[model samples]
Target: MELPEWHGPTDDAELDAIERKAFADSAALQLHLSNKSRIHDGVILEQEATEGAKSNQNHIALKDNGCGEFHRLRTRRLPDWSLLKRSCNEHRTKVKYPAIKFGGQIVYSRTALEAEKATNELLRLIKSNTHAHSGNEPFPMGLDIEWKPTFRRGERPRKAAVIQICVSRSHCFVMHIIHSGIPPLLRSLLEDNSFVKVGVGITNDATKMFKDHNINIGALEELSSLANLKLGGTAINWGLGSLTESLTSMELEKPYKIRCGNWEVNVLSKEQLLYAATDAYVSWYLHQILKRIPENSCGDEKPNQANAIA
Candidate 1:
């Protein structure tokens, strides 16, 4: 597998600032380990190539610089997240009757022509918003991707099945990648730096896009990074679920069920469409909230009540 390029801070001043700030945080060690793992993995791959041996997708063979022999590096497996699930009965009083209320319409495009039309409208929105003077102004686009689950161990990861883009709170376009692939207009928007793309853990999604379709996603900003920058020492690397719950006090109901659903199918179920669209829409919503917080507040400021979604 080709390792993704590290696209984080590159400028010396920015890197120094990030390093200084991150070093003061308790979670900084974890961040350093994550970056180190990427670098170490890249080095192992390079060594394998120099030795005229192809690296296995399932395992990494690293040559001991001191010794001439190569050894198989043990890959770290994450803990079973399913074991940590809480029973709904434990918090029956807290649960809402109808859990999620997404005030958005998910537009599914199964054909290329239909997908192209949606992409065109999205491009128009991006172009119209180019004249905004404020750097902190909310970008009109929120992006997210979904794919089929890989159950068996040692199996290659699946390609992205759906690329969901939310142009507005009430309007989302789901591009059926398995059926229609990425439209040229959509690709153009993704590659344009002036058009801001907001999402959580977006680098992983961008890597998949490049690996599967050779499409480069430009002008992308990870919401997690933004949150860290804004919150400073108090920041936690929260995923979509935690981030949404923290900011909006809303639960993303049955995300796992919809995530593992049959995304490769020709026609997606209403639940699948809603789940994908809501994920994208929430990213945009969170971006709006985060951007509104004053830069000097240092995690002390709450989101503006008027701007909060019901």
Candidate 2:
């Protein structure tokens, strides 16, 4: 599947810095693998790709055959995400590895996933022996937190899905929509100040937190409170996809994005879960980078208190 490409202005230094930091402090970095090996081997310990990538409803091939993620429909590929994928192995990949191309992706059976586990284990061995990349922290305390959202299946759909959550330990954090009635608890926990809840489109999360999870945080608290606190919300609204594009010049895979898939399936395939995880992680990860920089050095850091009702 074709992974979405964000074409926004990107400074190599910024990306390099984040990558260095991610591997330095992240569990994945601790594992010691190149970006590709990690995903193929360790990052996705429980998931495997199944199904080729396809177009998200937002995706549309232009007359020129070019696709658009915002103005038109989003493109998708069950394509492997090596852009951020990593592995601990330094051994040469077999002839078929790095088998990434643009397509929806072939679906896999649970049994097929077993094969992946074996491969990851081997890669882990290599990571264990590899030397460190520059800027690799022994045990940094950070994560990237990106997210992708979705709506509840078999319902009216007003309560959209915001299930994507990736944290950048350096690159991002691991994430989930978890709109399952726990938002208030998270918010109450955050009131302690040290709790430090961060997000890209946190307001959207907060609204869903209340709508789907009865968060009671209200629109203002969900959206503006963090901005008022000057913790998040700069020129962008924390739309992970938009922010990633703005920051990384990396447009993420958008296919199957607006398309409703079987999210509630009791047993989600590894590929499906990873797709969900990546979306959430990227958004959250972006801010983790922001928090490390001196506030004034970054762009307009908005008040976290000015939230809007969903």
Candidate 3:
């Protein structure tokens, strides 16, 4: 018999149905095994059990027979993710804490001239922001990238469409790179060793940028790694939104629709612009906050203070 191919059922009802079927199949199999154990010859059953135990020694067959079924069940039993998302929203609504907002002048560039100007402006900001004594220390610029997401099976990933960079609390630049190819000045700024691009999973972002634009990013600072080094207790992987909330006690309003929207559009909507800007701004702001915390301070001990993003 041919195994069923998964087409990525994402809806709650479909997930529920799949989970029910998997459970029923497991129950039936268990009942069949119990009946066979009672009716079959003991010697034959023992031999079969011994063979099954031996199969565990073969990684390939073990994965095929054991881990495969385990993953299928685990995948099928996934919780209603939509419900969890709704609950998070509801929690924010109940708490009445304001969502993270960007208080900055946003520059959206779609032409080479505009991109170059933005790049120059970013360099100026870096110059003004860094101290003279901080020579050769890469100025941390909050960075993020977005692309048109693919939902269809076997679809090739679209090249990155947007690149956002925030240098100060008052300014952010969003480049529609998919429209305006990375210009020489913009490329130089990205490759400049004096600036450190900061974000979550920035290595992956750098890799994707290099793949799509052939422009290699220079220095990168992963916020998770920074947080691990600064904060006390066991280290944990940190996502941008979660880290923001952990540090600032504010929701980073990431509406699913806007987040997963088409970044390749000719002009971004107001919501998308804000979303992009706020992400970069928060990254920069969080870095400042983490930097202020002493190296030996336990984050859990000063929850009240740590939660406040100056």
Alpha carbon lDDT of each predicted model: 0.58, 0.33, 0.64
- Displacement of residue 188 (Cα, Å) in model 1 is 1.1
Error of 1 at 250 (Å): 1.4
Model 1 ranges with Cα > 4 A deviation: 1-100, 127-140, 296-310
Better of 1 and 3 by TM-score: 3
Give per-residue CA lDDT, model 3, range 1-310, as digits (tens). 0112113212334323433343333333332332111101001111133334432121111112211232211111101110111221121122332576776578888888889888888788877877632455678889999998887879999999999999876688889899999999999889987788999899999999999999899999999888777654445556686666555545676676787789999988877887888888888777766665545344222223323221
Over 1-310, each residue of candidate 1 has an lDDT whose tens digit, in order, gives 0112222212334323323332232122332222111112212111132354433333445644221335655422211110112332231123232233345456678777878887876666656655653666445478889888777779998898899887554467788888888778778878877667888988889989999888998878889878666545434445776555434435555555677777899788777777787788778767865665544233334333343222
TM agreement with the true structure for every prediction:
0.63, 0.38, 0.66
TM-score of 2: 0.38
Candidate 2 wrong stretches, greater than 4 Å:
1-155, 158-193, 216-238, 257-259, 294-310
State which candidate has the highest TM-score. Answer: 3
Q: What range of 10 consecutive residues in model 3 has the weakest lDDT sum? A: 74-83
TM-score of 3: 0.66
Scanning candidate 1 in windows of ten residues, the lowest lDDT window is 76-85
How well is each residue in 84-121 modelled by candidate 2, as lDDT tens digits? Answer: 33343333232221211112212121222332342243
